[model samples]
Target chain A: MPENTQEGFIDQQKVLDNEEYSIKNTQSIIQKAVDWFRARSMFVLAYGTGCGAIEMPPIFTSRYDIERLGVVGVATPRQADILIVSGYCSYKTLKRVIRSYEQMNEPKYVIGLGSCTINGGMYWDSYNTIKKLDEYLPVDMYINGCMPRPEALIEGFVKLQDNIRNAKSEAGYIQYRENNAFYRANQEKIFGKNTTPTFEENFAGMNQ
Target chain B: MFNFAMTPLGNLFFGLTLIVFASLLLIKNERRDLPLHILLFASLGVIFYASDLITLFVGWEIMSWSSYFIIAKSARIETLQKYIIFNLAAGFALLGAIVLIVAFAGTTLYGEIDFGKVPEALRVPITLLLFVTIAIKSGIMPFHYWVVDTYEESDHIFSAILSAIISKAGIFLFIVIFSQIIGYRYLHGSLFDILAWLGVITSIVATFKAISQEELKRLLAYSSIAQIGYIVTVLALLEGSGIEAGLYHTIIHTLVKLLLFVNIASIIYITGKTKFSQLGNLLYDYPALFILLLIGIIALAGMPPLGGFNSKFLIYTTLLEKKKALLLVAVMFSSASAFLYCYKLIYGIYLGQASGDKEGYRELPMSFYIPQFIAAIILVLLGILPSLGIALFNPILGSLGFEVSSYSSLFELHTAFASFNGGVLMGLFGLVFALILLLVTSMRSKAVKVRDRYDISYCGETPDPQNNLHYGYGMGQELRRISFIRVILENSTATYWEHISKLSGDSSVMVKKLYSLGTQYIGLFILLFFTILLFLGVR
Candidate 1:
């Protein structure tokens, strides 16, 4: 989807302008490689709604230490790797929740928490509750509880760690390249065909 | 400690920049429709909490103007003008109050403010000015005209932030002013009494209009107003334990309202359906969202064991313990009246037979559902565990010079007697029964029917399902019949200021006309004006 930046546009322009693209080319390639490597530090956008969000502070703080785990909380989905749907979702919250999830990067993981994540838990029937968290998204891990304490939440962190390691080891970069159809289908089901495209950034003029 | 002096709202400001970046890239595409307003909201939480009043002021103005821009995006120019006018009025009031406080106490620092140290004469005016600013921001009664107009006009995502955080920040500021800074104990109870009455009036009136409205978003707007009234009334009460209960209501209300508003947006997004009259058979098309919205509506309506009931119950018990009998009646009336609006919201959108082919609408993506899913899960979990709401309120209450009550998160709310066990027990039992049914249905029914047609058999009369099952059909009509109470409350709360604005406008015009009576008398009028001005100035 990205426009051919290096060889096609830059090289062609150099030939037309009779300027050398070779002088700074190697330095640029090294910098690009460095950026790609550093950007690999995955940030998770923890959209913690309920009691499970209570567990996040401990996980991120000095206790369990999510930062040591190389997982820090980011503000928006675009900057995140994991989307933690901590607990209970109402129809009211679900709308924004869906928007946040869609906002995340291509390689994303969704973790459903508390008993509400698996089923409605105690509020299975008083209405205004979702029965299963997976029904809405392709959840990687689902933690069970009426309210999961901090200890169990750390356990979820460990499990997610293991899953990431395993997927990376077996699949290589190929799995990363694999189109996320499950995530795609979830998006299609929720947003429908008339997706308001994200073309707001009008970077109309750029020499590069 | 995060250095308040250095990075006051540092986390929030960076977040705001990201959203602005996203909005700038706000190509008219629907896929990336998050406006800059959404990002700016993250800024508000940090700004209001800063220890320095100067830092607080910056965040305050940014929040005001950013929100103003959002309103301007959707509302007519005139409405946007009114919105900004009201906000500017509050801003000027805030500036005047701060200047007076600085003059009297010789400090603009938040930590240095000591109400006891301030001279008595300056105290009342300062307190009055601060309270007016708080009232305007929180949309309490007469100063609240901006909220309804803004909510009705805003994009749903922006409205959700406005309802959840904007007013909350105002109430938060008021708590900071009254409890920590001003400490006006003698006047506290009477002030709350008036606010509680205003909340009752708004709830009774808004709930009535909420019931009658055919447009779904307007009903949600009314619901936001009524919910905020309860929040403001609780803030006015300012009790130690009630702070937790009040904030618990805020937490649950935010989660619950976000759930409802998002679901409302989903309906709008899916079918482009705005009114209840234009919508039907959604369950047949978008089943997942249908079921999700159904649960959200129920919990919001205060069904037991869901998140809404926990806080609503706590609010009731708090009133009862205070043994404010009249307050209890008002609480019950507002709580009960909510059902009318909530019922109409859900049934109007999702219930009844399908309008046509079941395949017309597709389910929304995980991106959108994630937001609702997170909020919904929290609502019910907290509802069953009302004590969780209190525990969360502990740190917030402690900052305001209050001790955190040891309320039970499970069945006991801090104090044993003050807690609620009824909703918890009932909710647990319901979950068990539903699971039992799910197992049985799966056991007996291996192969389920996959028929897609939602239409009825041709054995019948004119079979327009949507026409027959339109919103405003049964319950909506019945609610209208009992709507006289709403009509009364709408006319009931006309304040003294409404008449004042009218009176001043007319008086000023007459004075202007009298001064311009005739060109011939202009010289004499000028001479007389100078003579009178000199006499008054000399005295």
Candidate 2:
């Protein structure tokens, strides 16, 4: 009790215990209801960074008809719930991805599409392309394939939806918020100090 | 002798002038035009208070000439030519009408002269001349050729005066000469019908023209023409209720224009950019100005819970009471189409993304806000107490010998066809707005401010600073795709005027050729003219 009351002192054991307890018991009935609704209606802002963009059209259109599951495509990042980073993210592409990811409202998710986004695929040897997308952005799920098929992308979305509905894993946006420094350090390594949208400026008044 | 008396009508107009001129005084400018502005203000007073035709004409001339000089300070040679020509024509028409009135009534004084004594045949010409003068001054279409260019070219601060006060002077003249003095009973019904249609058409065309404009002032210039068009239409109805509605709209429009113009003037003062394409994403930087402009546009659009809606409600109800279905439809159509330009005005300047470097922009002077705040407050007050304007109009209507509209309270605008409670409407809107605001702000999801203006998502590629992202100039370009709009946009009054000028030029050249054919042909022509005159004299 004295340790808990001490200024500038954190009880690691108590904190871990509290974290486990909160994760298991703190989610109220209201939070579960909210998560249920959030999972049902998903607005995806599919940022076409590489070749994986071609698979999205068939799925969104009459062929695959992804809207049957309450998923829809929106125009702007502000309206989106999920951001799809499709295929390889080059150094230049990564900057915009980071900017767009930062702009979206919280409770947002990110799906890394294709092996290119995971390990750069064929562009792994290229100095320009980022090999691992998660190093820069908190990717919630990755569909693995050189160029992921439409079915694989659909599977990845289904898995993500299930995780979201059950609160099975922490959201990517929360992780991005908590561990922003590590991501920013990785970004600044390539873009230098002059990188646009520095963390300090973007998240200035935002609550931790 | 120049005679002046302050009647309720005169007081109403004088009150409007004082409000406009007082607000304009707050604006600081480099141009030493205060004396000219004062002269213009004095002339408006003379016109409003004058009880005699000679005094009225003198005031009218002074008003035109003073504004002419003010406009001339910044206008180009062609604009000056157009201004003087249109105004001179308007002046001549007024002079002709005054001469006719004096000759027919045998007295220049308004009270002494009985319009009933005037010959029936002569009344048509007098009214026609008065209509021409009013049309030119008030910018009724075809005669409206001078309005946009003159407004666009004038000093920004003076444009407020031009739209808010000078144009209303024409409305005053109509109410005085046509409604009160000549009396609508003496006029032909066909003339009022034609005038109503003309006003509605002018508003519709002007609204579309406003939308297609890229420049801010030019858009505002067309919008001014459009708003005045509504007042002119309702006044043409000539009923007591119609005139009441017209007066209410006049007051609302004056406040709205003052607020909007001063707001835009501050934007121009700070950024030195007048075109929509050059302005964007200024919402955060100048939040107060944005809110003021938002109020202005909302009022301008005539939505509920604003002074604009009360006037529009009155106008529609009056039209319904008169059973003017087609005319009301046209008016409503024009009013509906005005939303596009209203949205463009706010969105172009305040919303979207910043068009240029944020470092270059500076804060507007505190003095610039005085007029806007005054106008905005009055607009809100008028919205809360919609019939407050009607209460003010009662004495003026009584003085004009029209039955004054009755109201139970300041909040209730009672009409023959319909009535509404302003307080209830405003309260509901405020409550809903507050609830929605609370709901949005208190949401669990956090709203992240974008890192920068260029932080918008553009697929995967970063937007270059050089790339233009603002939809200000391009917002209305798509309207041209619609067939009816295309028809209206493609046809211009300028072309019609150009054709007339060309026709006159060709006819003059033919006369010049005939004169150059020889002195013999000139002598023969003069002989023929004199012979016709001598024959008429002999008869």
Can you tell me the CAPRI class of model 1?
A: incorrect
Off by over 4 Å in 1: A1-208, B1-35, B119-125, B184-188, B354-363, B408-411, B421-427, B430-432, B435-462, B473-475, B489-526, B530-539
Error of 1 at B229 (Å): 1.2
lDDT of 1 by residue, B1-539 (tens): 22143232232233333332332232232533355455465457546556656656667778888888766667777668657877787787787777776676676666687656667677667766776677678776667667676776777666666666676666667666677656646244565677667766666666766776778878887787777777666656667756656666766666666667667777776676677776766766667777677667767677876777766776776777676678779767877888877877777777755444334445554555655676777766765666666666666666666776765335555453355564556667788899998888877323323132222222212234445545443555565344566454345333554576569779999899978789768878899999999999999
> Proportion of native contacts found in each model?
0.00, 0.45
Question: Which residue runs does candidate 2 get wrong by more than 4 Å?
Answer: A1-41, A45-77, A83-100, A110-139, A142-162, A165-200, A203-208, B358-363, B502-522, B530-539
Error of 2 at A195 (Å): 6.6
The C-alpha TM-scores of every prediction are 0.62, 0.88
Top candidate (DockQ):
2
Listed per model in order, the count of residue pairs whose N, CA or C atoms clash below 3 Å is: 60, 0
Candidate 1 positional error at A18, Å: 99
